[model samples]
Target: MTPDAGSALAGLTGADSVAHWTQRYGHALMDTFGAPQRVLVRGEGPYVWDADGTRYLDLLGGIAVNSLGHAHPTLTAAISAQLGTLGHISNFFASPTQIALAERLLDLAGAPEGSRVFLTNSGTEANEAAFKMARRNTGLDESGNGVRRTRVLALEGGFHGRSMGALALTSKAAYREPFEPLPGGVEFLPFGDADALRAAFADGGGATVAAVVLEPIQGEAGVRPLPPGYLALARELTAAHGALLVLDEVQTGMGRTGTWLAHQHPHLGGGIVPDVVTLAKGLGGGFPVGAVVAYGERAATLLGRGQHGTTFGGNPVASAAALATIGVIDRDGLLAHVTDLGAWWRQQVAALGHPLVAEVRGEGLLIAVELTAPVAADVAARALAAGFVVNPCTPTTLRMAPPYVLTREQAATFTDFLAALPHDLGEATP
Candidate 1:
């Protein structure tokens, strides 16, 4: 199909589009998120054309899920070939791609020999599986106090996922309050605070805690990278106590942040290897897939054959997509490209000199701009009208996770537009 095939609604609709989505689809579909910024119709590379034919540079990369950019010939052909050959089969049976992807992920994370993997369909499911593995490994659950363990530790502003099991581990009140009566015994500590983290585990009866779950770099709350030595400290404390360290890499994994695993960074995450590593975004290069990479004894011993199962977890099509994505990332040397370009982009953005622009920070393609003014949502809208697309994480923060394949020219253009943001305010973006 031509790229135009994807723009089914472009040029043919406008005023009724938003209203139709609200009146017809809002009730029909779940209202988990509010109305979208625009009805995006089609995309190629960093450019997306909305229903109105307004082209936008997709700085969000579908929330860091599209690492190879959009519709690269290799990714498209790989998915098509796999779909044509063999799509999905029952989990009771396995395929080559499934096993290969799992092995590849372990190798990428630098897991020592004997590591294992569990596959899922979304980041939340991956975390759920990891949490379950932690519990099962402790030989508890399905029983009273002694049978089940309480006190799962999470970091403030850290987002793992949104399912019940994952939700219990998340510390956000807004995301957790509406759905109360959740599993209890979960504790929260300030993020990037080594002392607070040390204290939390210590207070949790330290050695008795089931596991410590946290994102190496908090993504959804606006690309918050952990301070240096924090992760290493977590590793040390978890070791001192016998608690499992679960690193939620759902956002920072799959080379979104320059390294295959953000934890490979020398300072923020560095060489510290957590007990459990969860990944999803950018795993399938825009397709739906998630995984938990557990090293050595932690992987295969999580559950027995009858303990867990999913209909589409290890399907061939998604696995093939993941394998292909990983292949493209490696063959193209995108990891180094990400690091160099990210540094350049961040440095250039910092030169904007807008007070609204307070700071620029992030690892690779995943970047966040803190503005002095609380007008992030407005700025995002303005950016869209200005023919670029960005996201407002907070009133004072702009989040940009453009694809790894982005060029220096694209980065320069973005810097210009960002510098003009203050002027665009009070007026329409264009």
Candidate 2:
């Protein structure tokens, strides 16, 4: 390394360390994310330390990415061992780890025979692959002469991803306005409105529909799950109309919702099977990996050879990291732990009777505390100052997705903070 770089690195622990790195971050990085929250140096389990050596409970889990928590021994060792053995062989070749992970995901999803998996490097890319799959399944005629379907339906408040195709499937106006003329034929339905969904599919509209993409739980829109029977209706309509049902489990999959996939939950998913399920976030625990699971022969063959591809996707190390994460979750029984702990924790927070808190909602550890006012940003700031990480996902919601390994004692600390929250905390809401 350069002498200047070495000197700057050595000063990371000095006084004014956060200020120094934050200033450097502004100059060296793009401002897409506004500003750095903290210069985190290291993490263990559910805790992380800033460059200044002040520790904080990581309740956000890297926006629901760090499933096994940071620097988990098993995840680390798996990545290291795989890298030592063989890291990247490109998509031109296959590895045992990649195959094993695909099999595991299919098994977890209860996929039918002839199902397949296409791996990617991020959630957005996984959705992109799913998008193409939807487009390809455009209801072919018996004679296979004319393309029949051309539209894809998504829900309002749904967040698929930011890339062009995935962004087209996302609903927020602010996210879509700037990128007008996106891949066309994506329509947004009112979230959880069975009437609107039915109307869209009525009057032969379903014939022109290619797919219905949805999130089991809308994470960015304040951790809202689809209203009961909504998913089942979608599945039924899609099946009747010959349209693909794609579930974007990027934020809700891989045990984040106390289940392998949120759609597997009886209450949330209504026991309906979707044709396509896209996954990422915690799939690799902390490593970068994503996947598109196409169920059945028809969906699996939508993307034939050369229809979709990636370079560093499904690399041995990433596959091993995902395998290790799945192993830990299964062996440790973190799914049941998350289900029980999340239910108990939400109840405890709600019982605190904090005036700012209007409601506590979500499944498993993926939670959102809705405020009576739009003071989520201010409350999140307070949480940071108090050595806890959280996300102001919306004006009135504080989202938390702590690691699965978090103990009740550690969770109680946050509840204690909530119980003692000041009444005037929202006075300076911005």
Each model's TM-score, in the order given? 0.91, 0.97
Each prediction's whole-model lDDT (CA) = 0.82, 0.92
lDDT (10s digit) by residue, model 1, range 165-211: 88988888999998898877678888778878877766557756777
Q: What TM-score does prediction 1 earn?
A: 0.91
| Residue 245 local lDDT, model 1 | 85
Alpha-carbon error at 291 in model 1, in Å? Answer: 0.6
Q: Write the per-residue lDDT of candidate 2 for residues 296-409, one digit (tens) a residue.
A: 999999998988899988999999999999999999999999999999999999998888889999999999999988988888888999999999999999999999999999
What stretches of model 1 exceed 4 Å from their correct place? 1-24, 139-149, 423-430
Where does the lowest 10-residue lDDT sum fall in candidate 2?
Answer: 1-10
Give the least accurate 10-residue stretch of model 1, judged by summed lDDT. 1-10
